[model samples]
Target: MTVLHQLRRALLKPPSFTQAYGGTRTLTSPYHTENNSTAFIKPDDQNNRKTQGKWLTLPPFNTTINGASLGKNIAGIRQSTGEGNESTTTAIKWVMRCCPQLPRSLVQKLFRLRQVRRKPLESSNSVGDVHASECQVKRVSAKDSMRFGDTVYLPITVEASPTEKTECLCTEEELKFLHDLELYKDSAIIVINKPTGMPVQGGIGIKRSLDELAGTYMRYELSEAPRLVHRLDRDSSGILVLGRTQYSATVLHSIFREKTIGASNIDLKSEKRFLQRKYWALVIGSPRRPQGLISVPLGKVVMDDGRSERITVVENVSTTASQHAITEYRVLDSSFHGLTWLELSPLTGRKHQLRVHCAEVLGTPIVGDYKYGWQAHKKWNRIQIASSNLEHKIEVCNKSSLPFGLNLESGSIADKQPNLHLHCKKMVLPDVSSAIKQACISSSDYDFADIKSLKFDAPLPPHMQRSWDILSS
Candidate 1:
């Protein structure tokens, strides 16, 4: 029988194997063929199929109300839909809507309740933000519980979270790699070497990233768990930042938005439109020179008759253009030794900015970079660079020094070619709160160093890590 047929037969029988990696399905889970009962299959089983749909294409979101960039702070907001069933805050009911404009006061109030998380984004799901559309206000002054008139559709963002999650793929040995580089931090602005081949968020398998592994060392290391201020590609590795508090999230965001140029991360709060950024990459072939810049404006292109993601671009600005972007790059090193090593400084943060700039603009894409680059650039999907992670593996955990089952045997080697070598490099800013609070702003005042490292090697998947060792040697 065909594998599909055998699988289908098994699916029709009693206990099923098709459903295991498929994970559990929900009331909202779509049928294999969308609204068709004849084509029912779990996600994991669907993976083996021809993938009639797109690979890693983000699922459609209930985005009806993605609250992008707005902190929940408003006191009371009343959307102007004027419909009786409009969204409200107090209603337990939820209805899907797309990017609703919420009242300012209601937005502010959510920030107070801690109902929303400001940073260390829920990158698993591609869905961005959600705000309720309509909700009924209640006054339960003397009672423990309150009554409601009708279901108010308040703006709500629902991220994809697993009902049962697995331990992060970041293993004990991997943690050591990061620990050697100053990976752990109690204060904000923590750094670590991100491993490649894992999505930043939302999945069924044992994958890990800064967001997934943040909790592993969070409590023991800092007063607060750090949150990522930005995103890195699943395959790319390099420097990344985390925020410990909302205030830090705010300051760091401002710094990124304004692209502040000063060294003190807190000092650039007042600077307007100034950003300094640098990154490193190991590409497929030797570059023209060790250094140069690639400039282009990126534009979103649609594809598959609108079935899935299109090739994202960095198109130059047109005289009558609606969008424009520019990226600068310089090759730091190159070799017939196999590939090109480069340093990139992005002047802008457009979608797929760096990847597209590398593949299309400069013609030297980061090795293992998925979603962009040349059709044949299929090395591994892990970027040669590590995330802002800058620490080396610490020998903190010892198998011979451990108890029974936990004692482990290990083997490893370094990459012949560098992994995605991107690093946040450095950023500076000013302490804008007050002089009294400024004393805490010392650069050396960081807390957790578990993620910190002295060396930059990450534990790769067996095959890739092996390849790296062979190449580097």
Candidate 2:
């Protein structure tokens, strides 16, 4: 036959175990068909044809191997390889490369298992043998077998533990109240319209709080009871978020701290914020400008009475334990009764930020805010008495020590005290539906369809509603 024809026949011939590695012994694999076998050719093996051992593929098995099952197989392989002096790390690497579906957990498990198995064996072995075994295991762990860079291919079937699930001890009435207060609910988060006088978290004298109520009442069929992601003042009524899972809490907390609202002129619009909180307040007066931004630094100050602490605008920005607080306000409506309905949006979440800004910066204090607005009200009353005619000063009584219009007879008291008029009216949160869906795709416990975008508005509380009604009338 011609040399060209012989070369052509050699090229066309199907690859056999003997043809590939000049051997009669065959390496069997389940992936192979009757006609063809997959060959793994190592660069070192190609050069050193005289090597004693041939690369062996995994034995054929009837059952399919998943991530956890593969972990067991890897443990066995690592244990066996550690016993022998031969370098099987290259073979394990080839197996991992070929079967990309194997999980990274398997690799870690293999190392851990090998170390554990080697410990007992090494205790009884000669010093030389223990040293050799340690060298081999360390070499495999350091360089060849454990390099699973970034991606991890875990099986869709994850084991769910019964211990992970939790139950709450709340009454039926509390559950109903929670249901009524709910603004939004999903697999990941629950947003509730918290009422004034209810603390977000428990304090020294606070017997009940939104957190306790949430733990009791918001236990929708989840592995654990929902947890609060952020806090609102005890007197501030508004939208509050609770994470249904630890993962959700972590994610939401990070998002709230990092994200921003409304796009800037720069490319910052592309990086959207996760949380947007808008508040409504009935202030005693209007701002000089109809709408404006307040960028002030605020710090905590202890009053002379030593019973309470309040946040005030810092004059000396250079030296103080102060944080930058920014708030945007717009006059929604104004009344002849010396009250203005203002929509306040805070860029930074400082304690009593909105109240301090209105009282100090804008020369307008929020109505029903005793801490900030009470002093302003007394001053205004004195000014009015001095300026007004005798007809206006006809009736004045100190029957109750409370502020002029804050008598119990007035229907403005929501709880025991005259409630703060500030309300968290609206909140905009990022849509985490896709993430929830992905997380729940393999989970039979949670229904993925229940997860959705978090955008909700809470109705004004009773006191604020009453004040609004009076102002509108």
Candidate 3:
């Protein structure tokens, strides 16, 4: 026989130990031809076509591995298939795309712990065949390439099973409370006037939050729950926005982030890509200028307790940690009793920016803002008490300026704690519902009538209105 014929015959010879084993064994070997293409062949007893493999070009080891036909492996786990082309995405990128809410740092930590795994590329079996047991437990690196059919296994910590968690985090009453607060709702977004003293998200010692309640009961007919697009402070009552869909949430988040970072470049009068938030604050004193901008840099300072932190105006303009804050203020009404109603428009979003600017920069701290305006409140109380005449004594004593039936007595009692007077009264931003619908449906046929900016107005909370009435009277 020729050398080539002899080599092929020898390669097809079965191993002597195969007879001792119960099941049939299959082996694939690559044969190179003159054209530099490689083909694989297997030895079989029944069919000649089954013995001859198809000619194919193998990709590099760094590329994604080929996937097997849809079949359960030895562990009864269904194997996924890959596309014909190679995938350029990394393992971590693929995981993040599958789970958008997961933090990147946590994914890196999982990779470091070797919790990310995948099925072996070579273990892919044909239709109705079972892969080796080891194939189901193979771990992969985060830097590894992800193929279309590759099954990337993340740890249980990454993807929690619904069966594992039996208890519901939100109660029925809380869900109803959230539903009652909804100001507007559509397919893309849900707007609510968040109540004062209620937290938007949970933290340490927080048993309940608005986000948990909304996600539990606000799903309606959608498969996924609503997600918060922006946050409102725990003590501030305002128009809070939540995205009903993932795409809308992502788009709204990007738009809000852009508005906060570059407020000067955004045109407030523009019909698109603009966010206008107007606040009504009951301040202790009136601004010297009727209406102007308060440009100041603010920074956070942790208290000596190491836990409590507060936002304050940074005296040094060169400080890198400080954030630039701009707010437009117009004096609405002033009272002879040392009170002023001010309309505030914050150009940039910052933590407690309005409270800090009003107290430190403009010297007119918001009423009931004890963190920044405690001293001003005490002075106003003393002045009002000293100048009290017998004629107006009964009126002042019967109707206190403080809300929630509380007086100016300072203590740990609930009656002494006052509510914040800074309220988010109005907002104007791009119509997220229309934008999402237009992107999903036919763009050419979409109507532009409802695409105009969405306008929302929230009335002041009872406490704020009472403070306004006291000031006006």
Candidate 4:
């Protein structure tokens, strides 16, 4: 054959050739016709065919291959695949089109190398440890700096030394008082009528609290002392529930967190149990409407002196620093003395929500509230003083602070006015059976078959009763 015709025939042949009768195959170079075993496909021709899917020739079996060049070729293929320019199907199709002698199964196996090498990098460390470290960083940075007037303040944390566990002490009279305070009790829970001037939980300089007394009171019936499921303000008397068992406590906590009682009737009638609490309060003046719902956000503002904090209606709703609080109030009775008796049902359990709502939103603070109440004793002097020369007065008082303004001390206002006139009158607990069933579904360890649903009503405390008697009379 002519040299030109042989060259053209080599160009027309496929890149990878197989013997037409399938034994051993020989690759002939386009430049040589001597049947040399050292002949190879030119680098330029191989690269151009790789890119353009054109036909070229493969090297003889004994031909020496450059390890570095082979690595570069594999890397180029991986890069193209990574960039989404080449997929497994496209690679297989290209391999078949350019090298018809290559098997489809072998091409599939070669494509799997990309996936094997591209596995996601995983760490040996636990995710919880990383999350806990992040939380520590956030906690360190969350120390709030509060400003009031000219002072910048930060809260101080006091660490107390561990004290010996001592049995609570109670006098016979006190024991009788505690027994009388029991509004309701069952296998799962105990409802107590907390009294005014009694702290629910001990605090700085406080030696005795209702919780201590409760421990002594229930020590006879329970091997493990009953645990208070929730807390009421120190001076705000009302119904309190104590869980007698761990399962009951967990269930009660979930109910309170979900605000089950305040949910709709459909929710109450569902499989889950619900609870409802009601309180009565006497505030100075009446709301413009006889009955209404107050929806406001509340946030605590530390005083400029850093000695105390006060709950107030958050004026700005855009910030996440404030919590949403809602309360429904009805004017039960209005007295000639400019006081109105109100029945309040809080929809959300925010600290001092009712107090802030009544004082700020309704323009009528509770009668004995010293912090958020009307400053009845502020003396206004009309002497025309220069605004620049007048110094702003700093007023400070120490009173028990409660969430949302519960039973805060009246301070100087207590001398003239009575104690906090708010009282938790009644509480409705969810059906014990339904709650236990739900708890069982959530946890296999729970079995509340012995517990029964309960409702309790607490008579108005002496201070509130006196005010009602005088105002109604």
Candidate whose TM-score is highest: 3
How many Å off is the CA of 242 in candidate 1? 0.5
In angstroms, the error of model 1 at 245 is 1.1
What are the lDDT scores of the predictions, listed in order?
0.38, 0.53, 0.60, 0.51
Q: lDDT-based ranking, best first?
A: 3, 2, 4, 1
Give per-model TM-scores: 0.45, 0.55, 0.63, 0.54
- Candidate 2 Cα outliers beyond 4 Å, as residue runs: 1-171, 260-274, 305-307, 380-417, 436-453
**What does the lDDT read for residue 330 in candidate 2?**
89
- Model 3 has an lDDT value of 0.60
- Candidate 4 runs further than 4 Å off: 1-164, 260-273, 374-415, 437-453
Candidate 1 local Cα displacement, residue 246, angstroms: 1.8
Give the alpha carbon lDDT tens digit for every residue of 108-224 in model 1.
Answer: 333333222111112222121112211112211111221221111111222111222354554576566546545434343455545444455546664445565664554233323
- Write the residue-wise lDDT of candidate 3 on 373-398 in tens digits: 99987776532322233233223333
Report the Cα lDDT for residue 3, model 1.
Answer: 39
Return whichever of 1 and 3 wins on TM-score.
3
What lDDT does candidate 4 reach at residue 92?
A: 33
True-structure RMSD for candidate 3? 16.2
Candidate 2's residue-wise lDDT over 318-349, tens digit each? 88788888888889998776678899988777
Q: Write the per-residue lDDT of candidate 4 for residues 27-105, one digit (tens) a residue.
A: 2332131211121223454333223222222221121122122222221212221232211222233223223223344
Residue 77, candidate 3: alpha-carbon lDDT: 26
* Model 2 TM-score (2 dp): 0.55
lDDT winner between 1 and 4, please give it: 4
In candidate 1 the C-alpha lDDT for residue 457 amounts to 25
